[model samples]
Structures are given as structure tokens and as C-alpha cells.
Target: MESATLTRPPAGSPAPSGPTARLHVERWPLIGLVLLCAATVFGFFYYPTYPNYDSLYSMLWGRELLHGQPLSFEAYRAPTQHPLAIVFGAVLSLLGQDGDRVLIAITFVSFIVLVAGLYRLASRAFTPAVGLIAAGLLCTRFDFPFLAARGYIDIPFLAMVVWAAALEQEQRRRGTPVFALLALAALMRPEAWLIIGLYFLWCAYPASWSQRITYAAWTAAGPVIWALTDLAVTGDPMFSLTHTSGLAEELGRAKGLSAVPSSTIDFLVRLDKAPVAIIGILGFALAAYLVPRRIWMPTALFLIGLGTFVMVGVAGLSVIQRYLLVPSLMVMVFAAVALGGFTMLEAGRLRTVWAAVAILTVLGGVYYTTTRVNLHVFENELRFRGDSRNALEDLLDNPKVRAGISCGPVSVPNHKQIADVRWLLDLPKSQVIARTDETQVERARRGGVAIYAANRAVLMRTVLIDGMKDPIMTQPLPGFRFVAASDGYGAYVRC
Candidate 1:
């Protein structure tokens, strides 16, 4: 097959107008259908059973809204609990079907949106052909399928960032819709806050003082609104922010900020299949040396995201590989641009070599997805969730336990770490009242709460070892009987 490239009009010619002209001039993402078909086929055979932990946390928020319960901000504010994803999960529940399938469907849709977003951004920055190739190459990377097979917010959040970039590139203006997409992304994850902040700074250079101020204000709005909402309910304006900060401080104090450099290097080695990571590195190199100056905006944005991820690690949060998606995306775009050739390789011999390489890279991705990662992700998720569900159900089925149990007190780290509270309590939100101090546990015994459940591990730690204190302040309280235990959880009912 011949290699494809965009056709630009001759110099001094007037820009073409109309939809027909646009179609002929721009490259469409023909590779998107391939991605769709692959995802659809994989989902049919290996739909995920276990929701990722953050995803389950978000679903609890959705469940809360569904039941018209108020969200408790003073409780551990799940960093993963974005309003949009919670809403998305709530909407998914309305189907009243098997939750596993609904979650699978969410992953499938997130894949499509991600591919489409990448294509749009590539098309705007380089060429439609480049965009198509970039999206195709992304589909082939080993980690992509494993991720696409689960309903992780990482992919959805990246999709929003890429799509916003596409719109900004195409419009050449800070339009309202673009800002809206960005705001949605920021609300979904704090990582996007880095991207949003960089954008505001970028605006300061070329934009008028008034325009910069307007964009800056818009950029600040999402976080401000989220903070205010937390304040309204929790009576503390900084509840969510402080929760995240406190976690970081604990982690930083224990692990030290030195962990950041190792985490960033680990990202380079493991974010994708080795070959794709190599290609991404090569793409970054080529973008700097060969691609047009116009591509610098995305390069800068990628660096900003990377720096932000490192700073997060410095704060003591574990930097997982998926956290690198924003930078990975820019690398893919750069790789696509590199593969397409800056000025389009001459026809015949060079074009033939280019086409061959593109086909092979894509085929490598297909083999990895079908033969390895898909089955791995599917089976592991099913096994993990099966055990988790068994533990949760064992607790829920005990006859003596009348109402849902408090997960325990708000201040304890283990309270947030307890496994499957969402499934155990059968409640809408993850926050059950906490019985942290002796007073709360006593209150629960005195008609305050009917039962309290904890992950077997969390229960052992809180009750036996730590006595629910930061430094083991007191002995375990009496009057609670163990009702049941399972592979992954334990329950106690007030006697």
C-alpha cells in the first residue's frame, strides 16, 4: 500500500471554503473504525468484572446522588471522586442491569472518545493523515488494551485534554467551549489543573491583558467551585484540598521527595510496550529537531504535565504508570508526525518503507492486544473482584446486622483504605458514619449505628494493633461481636 500524506495548496493561493472543500483538504480518521471494531470484539469475550478501585470509589458517589443522600466532604474526599464520572456511573446504574457489563461499556466508550480526541488533535497540529496514523499506533501499544478494557478515569480524562487541545488549535481563540471541556477535565482530576494552569500562562504571552485575565479567571473557576461545594456541606472550605495535602504530607514524610525522580524514569521505561516507548522517545526527539515550530505548544504542554506528575510523586503519592497518559499522548502525536515525515518522503522507495513500518507497528499492537493483555486484564479483574465480592456479601448477609455499618472514624487513614465499603454497606456513597473514637463506637452501640464493617485487614489494624489511634492510644473497645468474615472483609455488629 502507498503511504498517505496531506495535500497543501500552492503558495499564494486563496484558502479553500465550504464543507466539500474541507473534506477533500483534510484527512479523516479512517483508523478509528479499526479501533472501534477491536474494542467491541474484545469486550464481547472479556468484559471486565472488577472495577478499578478509584472507579468503584466514584460509583459510590453516583450511588449517593441516586438515593438523594448528601456527600460528606469532611470524610475522606476520594481524590478519584470527580463529579462527572460519578454522574456517568449514576447514569449507568439506571440501566438496572449487571454492573460488570455497564462498566465494560463505559471502558468501550472511553476508548472511542480517546481515539477520536487523539485523531482530532493530530489532524489540527500536523495533518489528518498524521492524526490517523497516531491514533492507529496508539491502539497497538501493549498497555492500551489492558487500560481500554477497564473503566479507569485515566483514559477519559486524557480524552478531554486532547479534545480541548484540538479545539484550541483549530479555532486559534480561547473559546468558551474549549474552556468548558478543560473545566470538565479539571473537575475530573486534579492533574488537569496543571494543564489548565499552563494554558493560562500561555495566554499571557500572546493575549491582551484583558483576555489573559478572563482566561485565568475561567481556569480558576473549577477548583474554586469544587472547594466551595465542599465547604457548604462539610463546614470546612478546605476539606478536599486538605485531605489530599495531608495524604501527601504523610507520604512525603515517610518516603521523601527523592522518590519523584525514580518514578519519572520508571514512566519512560514502562508506560507502554518497549517498542512504543522507544517510538515515543524518538518522536520527541524528531519533534524538537525536525517538526515545524508550530508543534512547540503541545511539547510545552506535555512537559508541564510531566512536571506536575513528578511534583505529585514528590508529595508522597504513588505515581502509577497510567498517570503518565497526558505526556504519553503528546509523544504519540510527535511520533505520528515523525513517522509521516516532515515534508512527506518522496514517492516510490521511501514511501514504500514508511508504509511497511507503519503497517508492522500497527500489527504488533494488534497481536499484543489480542494474544496477551486482554486476557490478562480480564481474568485478573474477575478473580480479584470475585474474592472481594464474596467477603462483602458475607458481611451483608449476617442476620444480626440490621442497618449499614459505619466504616469507622473520619481521621484514620485505614478508614479510607478499607476495602469494598461501597459493596459491603450497599449504600449510595462510600462514607458511612465513622466510629473512630470511643465516643463514636459507644454512640453506635447506643442506637447511633446498627453495625460496623471493615476490611478484615483494616479491622485487624484498627482494632487490634493501633486501637484506632495515630500512635496506638487506647485498647480495643468491647461490646462488638464478630458476625462473619470472608477472604477480603470482616464485619462486627454491636452486641
Candidate 2:
């Protein structure tokens, strides 16, 4: 692609000077491939680099697929989550692979593929040189890589988001390639729609107003097409969306906006421990700076796509920046430009300074990655893992307590675990509890429960779990046996 500037590069046009430029451009891909590979290997080899909560659930759903179970719109509660993820999970299970390993691998590969897609898309801009710079910076972004290597939908959604942008102008013949991939992704995670919408903008930008409306209709056709197929198979065209939207706000109003700043600090400060994120951000910034002027239309379109997305923060994600991952990844493209050394900067002194900044950003990213150990590998070292999985199993140790409820092969005790304990225990309840959490004990005290239990660790966990404890009543149950185990969680057994 030729530069759109009045002056060519050598005349202080901010373009590369000297014979090495083209050669460097040609070699951009190699660097992208190497950096991506390095980040991926590091992420997977370490302690899965994924939290054991939602990350683990996606893996479990995938295991279900491997077991020949049909994807029930109701079975895996997050109706909007991509079904493709579960399909991927099932395949891993069939191959007898560990769900975590497979999910992490898929995440890593998808990220690399997203970078390649960006490289292809960027080819229309800077020489391979600038594209490689973009790839490298993106490779080290503060948040993208960390989430990119998990079984979660954000990374894959991000890849598709870029892909849509690349095809912005290409006709359907070259656009929408076997949207089964998109459908599956959309099914597993509803947020993939953000990518779809962004890609649609890139695709429809060049059309006439009438044609733009047509393009809008056409872009939505992918989901419509899937809905029709779903209807044909399941007799409910909108079952997934209908089923999912209902559950979106199930958690209700969460703790609120305080989580945003805390998460931002986590994302940025984390750069010290995982430099790959910074590398990615800087490389993307460089690409933004170097993208050919003609390519600005598409890049601008990418930004619009991203902006609209975050504004639509879903019911479950309103309070946290982590939920902003979808939009964050999208904007990172422009951010790369920002890091690439400011597109608005004129050639000469400021440009030189911007270049210095970009170089420093990239250098800082590298230093962060090299020095940051994958400390999560030793996450198990800490107690109160924040994981609810197997928590019920571990806590209900008494034979009589375990015997009261029957689950698995034998009947789990008749007692059903209450709200907030769903993930760590069986759901849909074998038997209803009088209440859950705070209300639970109150009801148990009023009526008659053989045993009253509460996690004492809830009070002591002031340092670890956020919102760990709500409150224990000032009044005590007459015969309650309060047991505060050293595990940082307490158990109360009522006689």
C-alpha cells in the first residue's frame, strides 16, 4: 500500500527511510508468529493461567458434549454463551483430553489466529513492518492475552471481530464463511455479537445509504439463518436468545461501580508480572501509527464497532471492567495506534518523540513479560481458593450430614444446598432449603432444622474473598454447634 501523504517517506513524511524498510515489512509475519507462540506457550505451561470459576464451567459444559449429551438451551444456564465452546469441549473430552488443557490451547490458538487475521487486515495499511509492530504490541496487551488463553469466548469473539472488519468491503461470496463458527461462538457466549456487529460495520461502510440498510439486514442474516436452523431442529427459532436473556440479570444488581477501578489497577499493575500484555499494546499502537492513510476508514469503523459494544454492557457485567474485555480488545486496535505513537502527531520532532514512546512502550512490555513469572501456577498454595467447586463436598464431611442428602450414585442427603452454593453443588435441587445465606439461618431458626451451619471463615476471610460475608445475626440459635475450622471457613452444626 502506498502512503497517502503529500510527501513520500524520505522527505520527512513519517514513513520509513532507507533500503531496509521493505525487507523489514516482508518479515513482519515472522515476528508476529514468534511473539504469539512465546506468549501462548507461557500461558498454557503455567498454572492454566485461568481462574477456576467461570473458566472451569465452560470446560464442564464441553465435557458434557463429549458425553453425547445434546446442547440443551436450558441445560447450561448462560443461554447466550457460545455453544461452539461446548462443542469444542466435547471434542476434547472425546479425545480424552483434560478440559482445562484443551480450553487453554484453543484460546491460545484462537489468539494467534486473530493476530494473523489482523496482520492480513493490516496489510492494507503499513508495510509488513508496521503490521509486525502492531502484532507485537497486541501480543502484549494488558488484558487481551490473559483472557485470550482461556476457554472463554472473549478471545475467539475478538478474532471474529477483527475478521469481520477485514471483510468489511468484500461481498458475501468472500464474506460470511460458513458462519457455523460464528453461530457456535455466539451460542457459547452472547457477547460474540459485539464482534459480529463491529465486523458488520467494517463490511458495510462503503455502501450507499440504501445499500447500507440492506447490508444491515444482510449482516443480521447470519443469526437469523441460525435461528431458522434452530427452529427446524428444536422447534424454537429463538429458544437460545429467549432462554438466555431471562438469565442475563439473574445475579441482580451487583456490588456496583467500585469494581471498575479495582479491576483497572489489576489489569495495568499486572503488566509488571506479565509483560506480554504491554508488548501487545505497544505493537498495536505502532500499527495504528503506520497504517496507510487509505486504511483509516476501516480502522475508524473498528473503533465505532467497539464503542457501541461497551455501551451495551449486559445484565451480568454492569459492575466490572473484566466484563469490558470484549470492548477493551476491540479498542486495543486503535490503542495500538495510540501506542504506535499517535496518528495525530505531525512528522519531525513530535513524531520522533512518539516513536521513542512507542519503542519504550514495547520495551517496557518485553521487560514485564520476561520478569513476570507465571505465579498463578502456584495458586493452589493459598487456601480459600475462592473456588466453590467441591466446596460442598469438602464441607459436608459428617457421615450423617452426607447421608441426609443423596446425590451421585446414592441419594444425596435430602437437604438441598441454597443460593450462591449452586456452582459447588448440585443444581435444580433434590430438595428445597428453607432459605439461602442470611435468610436461610433465620428461617432455620424459626422453623426447625436439625442442623444450622455457617462458614466462620466468612468473617476471617477479610483479606481474601471480597463480599465473603454478609452478616451473622446477633442472636444465636439455642442449640447451635458453631465450628470454626482452621480452613478460614466456618461450619455451624445444629443439634
Candidate 3:
């Protein structure tokens, strides 16, 4: 944590002075970038931030945990996501309100930590300029800032990965703290588990037989603990991994092992869309010729891990750009190494190229900050299809609607339908029934003959509910009368 310098001048030499001197020696640029990222996040939250279904699910899970409720939620809660939510929920419980503030705090702190970690890694592995470049580029990489603002589980997990990798050499001197951090990272995302495995594989090459086994054993603790925790939480040892696999299959994202070529192409294409990626790729391409041996293991892990992730589509996961953030950072480190070599070039032409790279990086940073910062406030309005679920909930003031049927219980329905019902109607998993099956539909109908409600979007999306396509309020089933309706929803009364 000492002040990072571009170089250490000779002892007894006059140290540099003034703003230019401070610019070369100080961490202020990194600080400035972090502040910019934080400001952008603040701008995003100035509006009512409503996250996607996963965020809502996490909050609900966390809220239940805070209330001392059992883990009775029907959906699979992955180990990587739930712990953070539970902690967030517990904190929210004490705060009385300000859940949004808590979310923003977690994300902003993680963003800052991630920036700091990247700077440290780049500084140690390459140079202060490289470190500064890497951090600055990350802040500007459009998705990076937004992802942090959204407060997903990835940023915190990535922060741990960055710090662990940065301090990896110190692992030998300081003991097994990096392993502990990696273990925690595994609890955040399964990618760290693979990284740990890959690290141990690299360690095995030069290590003595006993040393190799000890190191492997040390690395095994993370996955082993993860599996044990999964067993304890879900009663299935591999549920987190397996459940994700099944969900991916259901979502039609699973390609088994056959998706390697296309997934790799897709991953690369998506990666290139990030503004910082081109520079990182250029640096990595140059690193192949220059500084080939430096940080070779981390470089290989990034390639192999990413290639395998693309190929196998781990846990049947879809290719998300943010999933590659850690590997991207690795490439950025390699790029920094390349830049370091370029700066040391003997020829004027090569040095000019290095200067251009520096100039491009600085300009990119400015452009990213200037363009991405804007505050757009959206009203906290809840509209399910055309009907304002918010208005209906207020008008009805019915507690039973909390457990009432709206859209089908299964996830095949439009996500907004499920989320709206869960959020506005307060529907619990047990009371919900899948409308996909005639048996479930009949059962739900017979169980409650008084009223029925469903969102039209779900009806439109699924064939099973295609019977409910009337322009006006109309019964999709017999013994039901058209009662009232909203723009996106239809309500019915049983005769």
C-alpha cells in the first residue's frame, strides 16, 4: 500500500518535484478514476433503480433470512449469490429502510476495491503507467461501471479475484491468505474455483511431489467446502452446479460440449464490443512477442479458463460479457507488460507507438466518463402489461391476492409476470400453480372459484394459456365470467 512510483531514482539523487512529479509518483490518477466510477454509479441511482428478477429474488431470499424464515423459496439459490444477499438483508433489517442505499454502498465499495486491486496488480506485475492505464480503462469500460451500479454478485467476486491474484507472490511469503480469499471468491462465483484449480495445476510443474499434493489439498478446500455448504443448504451436494446446468438446458443455452467453436466466437465478439477490449487485445497480442515468460501462468489460465468456459459453457451458462472481467483484467495485465516493453524500446518509432497507446488510453478514459454520466429519474411506476398492478393492489386491498393465482407458477411465463405477481400480489411459491398443465389449472380453478387473474403477456407467450386472448374481459375457461380488467391484465369472477 506504499505510494506507487513510476521508477525509483538512484539514492541521494534529487527527487522530482511539482505537479508533473506528483503525477508520475502518486496514486491520484487511480483515485480520480475511482471517484469517476463512483460518480457514475451515483447518477444511475438518482432514479428509482429496479433491478431484474435475480436481484428481486436475492432480496426476497435475504429478507426472509433476516426475518428468520426458512429457505422455503421454490427457486434454486446458488451459493455464490445467496450469502451476500442474506448479509445485505440482515443489514437492511437493522436500517429499517434504505435498502437501495445498502445496495449502492455494496456496489460502490466493491467498485472502489476492484479499482484499487487492479492498480496494485498492474503496478506490481508491470509498471505504474500500466497500473494506471489498466484501472482507468476498467472504469471506462462501459459495462464495468454499470455492472457495479446494478449491484450484482459479480463485482464483489471479481474484486476478491483481483486482490488474490495481485498478492499471489506474497502467498509464498505470507502464508495461505490468498487461498482463503479464493475460497471466499468461490462462494461468490464458481469461476474462482476453476482459477484455483488452474493455479494448482501450474504449481504442480515445478513443485516437489509432496509440495504438489499439499498445494492441491490446500486448493481443494474451497470446492469441498462449497459442495458441503450446498448439501447443507439445498440437500443436494452438487445442486448449485447441477441446478444451473439444468436451468441453462431449460433456457436452451446449453450446448453440451458442441458449442466450443461458436461460443468462443460469440465470447470474443461480445468482448470486442467493450471499448477497452481492443486496447487490451492489442496489448495481449504484443505480449505474445514481448514479455512472453512474465506472468505466463496467469495468462495461460485466462486463455484456457475462458476457452473452456466458452467451450463447455460451464453449468450450462450463457456467455455474459461480465463473466470475462477477471480474464479481461489478466489480459489487461499482459497488455500492461507489452506496454512496459514498448516504453523500453530503443527505436523512436516504437516509442512513438507506446506514446500513442498512452494517449489513446487517456482519451478513452475521458470519453467514457463524459458520455456515460447522466441522471435520468424514472417514476416508481408498476405496470403489468397494460394494467397498473400498483393501482389494482391499492384498490383491491386484498391480502388473499398475495397468494392468489395470476400468471402460471412455473418460470416459463414472461419474467415480468412472475415478478409482478410476486412483488405486487405477494404470491408465495406454495399457493402458485402452473397454468401450463391442464391438471394444475383445473386444480387452481376448483380450489378457488371466486376470482381469477392473469397477466396477458404470459398468456401471449405460452400456448397453454392461449385460450385467454379475448379483446375484452372474457373467460378463458367455463364457469368464469368477465369481471374487470386492466391494460395488461384480466380479472374474472366464477359464476
* Candidate 2, 1-495: lDDT as tens digits: 233431223211234557797566556577658866886787566534433335554444555445544443343233343445545655655544344556667777888888876665443343343445456555655356656543556677667656654554223324345243444445545555555555456556665687567546655655665576467536888775555444444434233234445555454334322343454455454544444453453445445443433343333244444444533443444445555434434577766787787778667756755676454543442223333223543554545444433422111111122322332333332222422233345444542222223354433332122223222322234554544322323344443
Instruction: Pick the TM-score winner.
Output: 1
lDDT of 3 by residue, 1-495 (tens): 111222332112333689887677675664676576667565555533433445555565566566666554344322234454555555654653355346656766787888878877666554566677667656645466556655666788888887877776323322256666776776666677777776777667877888777777768776787677567667887766677666565545535556656655466445434444565677766655544433453565477557647644544655555566667667656555544535434457766787787777657756774786442211222122123434334423444332233432322122233433444434454444334334455554553322224554434433224243332222345554455444444444342
Better of 1 and 3 by lDDT: 1
Query: What are the runs in model 2 whose C-alpha is more than 4 Å off?
Result: 1-23, 26-28, 49-52, 58-80, 95-97, 167-173, 178-185, 191-303, 310-327, 338-495
Please list the C-alpha lDDT of all candidates, in the order they appear.
0.60, 0.47, 0.54
Order the candidates by lDDT, highest first — what do you get? 1, 3, 2
lDDT of 1 by residue, 153-179 (tens): 777777888888877766656656777
- Using lDDT as the yardstick, the better of models 1 and 2 is 1
Which candidate should be chosen as best, given lDDT against the real structure? Answer: 1
Q: Can you rank all candidates by TM-score, best first?
A: 1, 3, 2
What would the TM-score be for candidate 2 when compared with the true structure? 0.59
lDDT of 2 at 408: 22
